[model samples]
Target: MIAVLIILVSCCCFIFSTWYTMYKNRNLPPGPTPLPLIGNLLNIERGALVNSLMTLWKQFGPVYTLYFGSKPVIVICGYEAFKEALVDQNDAFGARGETPALDPFAKSRRIIFTNGERWKLMRTFTFKTLKDFGFGKKSFEGKIQEETRCVMEELRRSQGQPMNPARCFSYAFVNVLCSVIFGERFEYSDKRFSKLIGIVDDIFHTMCSIWGQEKNDPSSPFTSENLLYVLHSLFMGASDTVSTTLRHALLIFLKYPDAEDKVREEIDRVIGRDRLPRMDDRLNMPYTQAVMHEVQRFSDIAPLNGPHMVTKDVQFRGYFIPKGTNIYPLLCTVHRDPTQFATPYKFNPNHFLDEKGQFKRNDAWMPFSAGKRMCPGEYMARMEFFIALTTILQNFTLSSEKEFTEDEVAPKLAGFLNFPIQYELSFIPR
Candidate 1:
């Protein structure tokens, strides 16, 4: 009789606590009611995180709240909502929010995870260093051109036999970044380099994102640990985006051979078989540009994007989001916005092509994200993708033994990043 009374009292306390918590946060945007501890966990489907968030967007509209445990995360979706929060109201939403899965590991030391003053200093110093190293400029093309030559030779050795190009793509892309960071590039045969890449791969299979320095102050952000973490962030970011995009691009190319043929045709017409493609050449190659934009749009690489925090209390679309509230500016919604893309789900290059077949920009094509927290490597990544892909088409025809179905060609739309299914293809020399 005493044990039963204790259990009954515990249940009553739990009920009261939950009710009080819900009532306190009643002003937050409406969505599915959350449980006491594991708030909204049941609402999310297993192994389909991006899709689940998107479904919530449809149900609750663009701006709504979901609970992760007791903490409320304000999810901002669609192009208009994103623009308002990230661009227009940039300062309020500029701060980095807690990524609980990554918080322990990151410790807010790296540029990618920190907020306020430390973030500004890290970002400023890192961008200046990256610029000095020729990140987004024309001078950086030399490194890419040299890497492209090496990649082509590696492909030639494949002898038209089917092979997974993921490793080769990784080596080439990472080497360019390594050149910037370490002032050197590792050989493809370097065992230590390969092992290090493997470790980074394991971490990505596990969570993912980066930099800098003041002087000898105790409060300075320039410690050896900080520097190491910054390099770690750069390596992870550098290796992932271009390589993953290339993998998806190749898969899409195989799925649409006509698109591949057009890319090759344009390459031959403009760049010719004798020379490598240049950034200047991108201007005249409208179809190739359209294809690259479409690839990024359809691939939707970083779907959830990084979590952001509100620096101050703000009103958004008739919702009251408190200061320090975590925000999810869903990139998947922006890229897949039906109002923005003519065929949001399909791999249609025409979304970026005008009536005259010239390349046109879509405001919603935000694969790198937007505003103050926008990717620092946007310009470099754009150049890399353009040059690397144009170079590939300039030399080889992408061919696969197994034909990809429409579903296979579509983005997986799951997890932190969307990766294409593992498949082999031949780099049949043009």
Candidate 2:
């Protein structure tokens, strides 16, 4: 009787382990083999999630899965997979992945990182508020114009000397958001605003630190974490990405002086030498618009839109994705997929221009992402980049301060965001 009881328990344990293993591996997308308990966590870098995933896509097919400590993460690569997941089944993938660290910080409020009804409410409110402020309005153009004037003044004060445009551009960009959300502009030297920016900067720096960990110890304000996450996403999304793209734009122009001359010719013919290019003239400037699109495509910032989680069990293409599976949309794979973009690796403005020489929209061009969880600040970002780039280009001829080549200005991966290594440039007044 004792031997029979022991045998029965041993059999039951073996069966349970086998069932669990099968359940975890069954009907999932193809990916790197995960260990029995560790999953793919060991394969991934501590902080460089995007780079690691992109490398995986090169090995695995476009659509693959990864595991984060037994948690399944679906990585959608190439344009087709990204479109299908983000657009076709938008509602199914609307939920954001909950992280132990982010939960305490977010409290699940704010538009950038919330889900469900809260996401809907925050998005709608933000959209309406932005529309009321200046999006799609005549006054909106005026606000951008005002900000451009300030940027131009600062550039002019540089006296055609080499200077870091990052600070000036960031201040102007943040002020644009401030004008709409906070309803005021901050002085460049304001202590409080400066501190806020510093805090935001720290959050970004911390996010990229692999050794950093979030502590939920007592005596910490909830608002501090909340503000940190919000400002981190904002600064990371807005400042580093756009500034890097603009830096690349300058490098591209210098490398191809003919294109630069053509852009200047277009601006000269459309707006003339005395006045700066205005938002209203965007329609008439096909080359400039094409250049902007190419810059976005070539830079391919934010290759993956962070991680998203499955809220319910889902089955697709003969695969069963259980509840709580995480999904990562690989925007870089989509943007650079040979199947989608012609000569995907080449920097070509014609990709965004039609035979008629007018601006054309490409469905495959999804720098801001797509679907229910697409970038809420898409319109605002476009406006900022357009106003900032065209405004600066219209007034100045940009080139490297030293004899820096395009290869020298190429971006080195900095966490998820790719930025041009520290390089200086001269913005000689046109």
The list of candidate 1 runs beyond 4 A from truth reads: 23-25, 107-109, 208-214
Worst 10 residues of 2 by lDDT: 208-217
Cα lDDT of candidate 1 equals 0.86
| Predicted candidate 1 versus true structure: per-residue lDDT over 1-430, tens digit per residue | 9999999999989977975685465578888888777888999999888888899999999998888878889999999999999999999999998887876667533788888898897788678777778877776888889888999999999999999998998888889888766788888999988988887777766764122334567776666667777667777776778999999999999999999999989999998988888999989999999999999989999999999999998989888888999999999999989999888889999999999999999889899899999998888888889888988888888887798899988867444788888899998887
lDDT scores in order: 0.86, 0.71
lDDT of 1 at 36: 73
- Model number with the top TM-score: 1
Model 1 TM-score? 0.95
Off by over 4 Å in 2: 1-24, 45-51, 99-109, 209-241, 404-407
**Could you give candidate 2's per-residue lDDT for residues 153-190 as a string of tens digits?**
88888887788777777667766666655678777678
Cα RMSD for candidates in order: 2.3, 6.9
Residue 233, model 2, lDDT: 61
lDDT of 2 at 109: 34
Which prediction has the highest lDDT against the true structure? 1
